[model samples]
Target chain A: MSAFKEFSKGIYAENPVFKQALGLCPTLAVSNSVENGLGMGLAATFVLVCSNVIISLIRKSVPPKIRIPIYIVVIATFVTMIDLSMAGFFPALHKSLGIFVPLIVVNCIILGRAEAYAGKNNAGLSFLDGLGMGIGFTLALMLLGVIRELLGNGSLFGLPMLGAHFEPVLIMILPPGAFLTIGFVLGFFNWLENRRQNN
Target chain B: MKDILKLSSILMLITTIAATALAAVYSVTKPRIELKKQEALNAAKSVALPGADLNAIYDVKGNDKVLYYSGYMDTTKSNLVGYAFLTSGRGYSSDIESIVGVDSTGNIIGIQVLSQTETPGLGTRIEEIRYGESLTWVQKQFIGKSAKNLAVDKDGGEIQSITGATISSRAVTNSIVAGYEDLLKQLKETN
Candidate 1:
């Protein structure tokens, strides 16, 4: 596949959350609200983009024996930058994101892109791949957030669309709800892809 | 020999860089974090006491420390109203932070939860309209009553616990009770 095709495919055709099932920690954790999911998704994107560029630049020097460690350090450093910016500028968002921000260093999407694409591709290609992948991840998270907030909260972003007495589904906002919703969404996407192939 | 030296030097450089970066980030963000926390405390206090003028506020112990915001009535001028205290306890899932208002008479006027991460639709009822906003059912149990009554009604106290959220109800009550007992004793000596 062309570099652009590989990158854009992640957007929805092979979304990390709904399709490939990658980078799930923040996907499930911060997705309680669109605001939180979007925040975390962007942070992950920045780290993914920076890590991809640096990894591609230094791919030759990364001894195969220590390549994993090198990629980790690059990703970790960028994650720290996002963490610091959030803490300094958006304290509330920082508090909500909390430990998940630091945990981005190990997100498979970042490491997977670095090791697979960045290791083999030119700097330009790796950057595009990362950007595309990040956008895909972010869009998935926003979708999850919208559905969860609307169902559980009886509103969107704390705004009530339903009447005051509209009792929200208590189960929709709980931990089990996250697992169930994501599972059903994944299955539906797979069914759609399968039907298209059969045709 | 040269290879070993190069590897060691690179590793050392990475460690130093990482430590310096983390330290710098902490230094810049620490103040903003603290200020945001203080602003939250002020907001909580204003909600607890609608008309009183706040004097000062600060934290004690740890992240779990009790936050105290003292204020004086505009009319009495010198009379000290009870201190609005932030307290918490280890609930079944997450720690609960609540602000309990105490009048000078050692009576609890009201209480409100600042923030929490408990089970949504379940323990989150602490912030629900009936329990948090209307506060008539839950918050009323604390009003006019002293710390002595801070227990589940099943435990032979006046507090009416939520049907399904008993643990969370008990968690807030116990924290308020313990905090009041300790603060009341300290206030006795000062008076």
Candidate 2:
């Protein structure tokens, strides 16, 4: 694939959340607010890009049999760095993100990219893949967040948008709301794809 | 056997590098993290005991489970604002942590739910304030009420549990009551 395509694939064709369905845990959990989704997206992206570059660099020496563990350790280290730095500098955001921040260590997206793409690709391509995937993931989460927040809280990013008269759909902010919103979004995307093919 | 040796050695090297990186990051971030935590706690204290003299605040040895801090208005100690303590209890899911402030008379000045993993929209309502002329705030319910008065209304106490979060509400109330009793015992001993 061309360099631009390598970087752009994750934005649509190989989208992490929507197309690949990776990292749904953080995608759903943190998508309650735009700020939260953005934070998680950027954090995951940082971990993804760093781990990808490192994993690609060392892939030549790493025996395939032990590659998984090494990738995990590398990904975990970056996750801890992000977690600690977030706690230190962005205490409030860190507190709000809570366990999800640390939980990123187990997010399959980072490790999946490391194993599937970075292990075989060159460093530059691996880096682009991570950047694209991370941005796609962040955008997906933000979309979910915007919809849920607007309907559930009648606000966007905690700012009142719908005004006082608008009674928020209380369910939209709850767990079930996440499932409902994601289900409809996936369905809409599928329908659009099908229509395009039919045309 | 030769291949296994190579694999194990490579893995070890990777692990060592990761460990070193993490240790370095921890060293750089540790002090800053501690400072942030202290700042957050200080902010929570001021909110829980608004107007309490931050300079006069002192720590008291409590059962190791909970740390206690008391703040006074003046050096003479005539105006004792309240005692602030950290308390946690098993809620519907995760442990609900709260900072509770109580005056010398054992009346709660205020309580703030510092952190919780309760179910959103339901159990999370413990942190919500209902809108109306009467003004019903869940955590604020305990404010000005004594430990003896701290039970769910369903249990014949003043507190009205959140409709779908009775367990969480009860957990917070019980934790506060327990902390209050402990504080009272300590105050008596000090006196």
Q: lDDT of each prediction vs. the true structure?
A: 0.76, 0.83
Candidate number achieving the greatest TM-score relative to the actual structure: 2
Clashing pairs in 2: none
Choose the strongest candidate by lDDT. 2
iRMSD, per candidate, in listed order: 3.3, 2.5
Per-model RMSD to reference: 3.8, 2.9
Give the TM-score of candidate 1 (chain A).
0.95
Instruction: Point out the worst 10-residue segment of candidate 2 chain B by lDDT.
Output: B130-139
- What's the TM-score of chain B for every model shown? 0.76, 0.87
TM-score of chain A of each: 0.95, 0.97
